[model samples]
Target: MLAFAGAGLWLLLAGPADVLGIDSGNAGMVLLMTATWTALYQVGRLPPEDVVRVGSPAEWKAWIGTAFMAAAIAYFLTRGEVLAGVTVFNDPHAQRIGRNLVLLLVAWSVLSSVMASRWKGVVEQDERDREIAAQASGWGRGALVAVVIGLAVLLGLSPASRLAWASHLMIANLLIFALMWSCFVEYAATAAYYWRERRWQ
Candidate 1:
C-alpha cells in the first residue's frame, strides 16, 4: 500500500512537468527521493504474511519478473520519442520514465532480497517448480523468436522511402516492447502453473 502510494505520488508530482519538458532537475531529484523512501519502507515494513503468500522460489521469481517487466512496458509506452543525435536520458520525459523504472526495479529487488533473507531455508524449489520454470522459459523464448521474426518481416516489407516506416528509434522501441512482452508472458505462465499446482494439492 505504501509502495503504491509512493509511486502514485511520484507520478502525480513529476509526470506532467516531465512530459511538458519543465522543471527537469528538481523533478528528477524528487523522484529519486520518493523511490528511495518507498523502497526502504516496503522492504523494512511489509508484513511477513504478505511475503509468505508469494509462495515458492518460482512464484517469487515470477512475481518480481512480472512487476519489473510491467514497469518497463509502462515506461516505454509513456516515453515520447528519441530524436536524432539525442540521448534518451537528455529527454525529460524519457529520463523521468527511466528513473521510475529503475526505482521500481530497485524496490522489487529490495523486497525480494528481504524476503529471501528471512525465508532462506524454506524457499527451496522442488522438481515441479523446475519443470514449470523450464516450460515457461521455453514459451518465453518461442514468443521472443516469433516477435523478432515478425518485426523483421514487417520492416523488410516496408518501403524504404517512408520516414515513419523506417524510423530506427521506432523499430528499436518495438524490439524492446517485444522482449518485455515475452518476459511478461513467461512470468504469467509461471504464475499460472504455480496457481494450478496449489489448486490441485
Candidate 2:
C-alpha cells in the first residue's frame, strides 16, 4: 500500500490540477481509465485450475473483441489528443492508434490466459516469478521510504518553501513518478519471473 500512500501524498501536496493537467471531468476520466485497465487485466488473468469452463474459443474471442471496443471508446475520449500535432487529422489518427494499442493489449492478455489454461497437465509453480515479484516489491517500498524521508528533510530544512505551493506540487509529481515507475518495474519483474521459471523447469 505504500504506492497508494505515496500517490495520496502527492495528490494532497500537488492537488489534482497540477499533476493531471486537465479539468475535473477529464481528470476523473483518467482515474476511470486507470481503474478499468487494471480491472481488465486482472479479469483476464484467472488461474487455469479454476475449472469454471471459462467458455469456448468463440466466447473468448467475443470477450477480447469487447475489450478492444471498450478501449477504443476510452482512447478517443481521453488520450486521443496526446498524440496530436497542430494538423487536422493528427488528433483523430492518434486516437485511433491509441485505441488500437489498447485493444491489442487486451487481446493479448486474454489470448495468453486462454493458451495457458489449455495445458493438459498440472501447472507447475515458477520460482523465478516469485523472485522477480519479491524484487519489485522491495524496490517499490524503497521508493516510498526514500520519498518520505526526502520530503521530511526538505521541509525541515526550509519550512518557508512549503508556503510557495509549487514546492509541494513538485514533490507531489516526484512522488507520482516514483510510485508509477516502481509499479512498472514490479510488473516487469513479475513477468520476467514467470518467464524464467518456465525456462528453468
Candidate 3:
C-alpha cells in the first residue's frame, strides 16, 4: 500500500512530461514483475499447513480482490499513459490498455464468484469476521471521502493553465487511485486487527 501510494505521489510531483521522459510504461512493467516474483517467493516459503490456511476460500477471496484492485489501479495509471502523456482518453494505445484491463477485471470477478459458489457450504463467516469487515469498511469510506475532498480543493485552487492540463482521464484516474488506495488501507487495517486478535487468543 505504501509503495503504491508513493508511486502515485511520485507521478503527481513529476508530472506527465517527466514521467514520459522516464518511460513510465517500462517502470510500471518492472514494478509488476517484481511484485509477481515476490508473491511467488512468499508462497514458496509457506509451510504445508500455512499454505492450506492461506488457500482457504475466504482468504482467497480477499487476496484476489486486493490483487485485482491494486493491479487495476496500477495498470490503468501506468499502462494507459496517464502518467506519461497528456490524456489517456485521446491515446489509442491507452484506450486499448484500459479496455483490456476492464476485461481482465471482469474475468477475475466472474472466476471468484464461481469459486465462492463452490465453497459456499464450506466457508462460513463468524461475528469476528463481520466486526472486522464493518470496521474496515468505515475506514475505507472515510479515507476515500477525505481523498475526494482534498483533490477537489487542490483543483479548485489551481490556476487556469494548470487546470487545463487536468483532463477528464486524469481526473478519472485520480478517483480510481483514491478508491483503490482506500481498499488497500481497509485490507491492511483488517489484517492488523486479525493479527492482534490472534496474538491475544
Model 1: per-residue Cα lDDT over 34-153, one tens digit each = 664566467547565666665776686786567556655665665544322234435655554556656655666766675567556564677888899999998899889999998888
Error of 3 at 69 (Å): 1.9
Q: Evaluate all candidate structures by whole-model CA lDDT and list the values in order.
A: 0.65, 0.46, 0.61
Evaluate model 1: give its lDDT.
0.65
Provide the lDDT at 5 for model 2: 31
TM-score of each: 0.68, 0.34, 0.63
Ranking by TM-score: 1, 3, 2
Give the winner by TM-score: 1 or 3: 1
Q: Candidate 1 — which pairs collide?
A: none
Candidate 1, position 42, lDDT: 71
Name the weakest run of 10 consecutive residues (lDDT summed) in model 2. 79-88
Error of 1 at 146 (Å): 2.2
Whole-structure CA lDDT of model 3: 0.61
True-structure RMSD, every candidate: 4.8, 14.7, 7.0
Q: Report the number of the highest-lDDT candidate.
A: 1
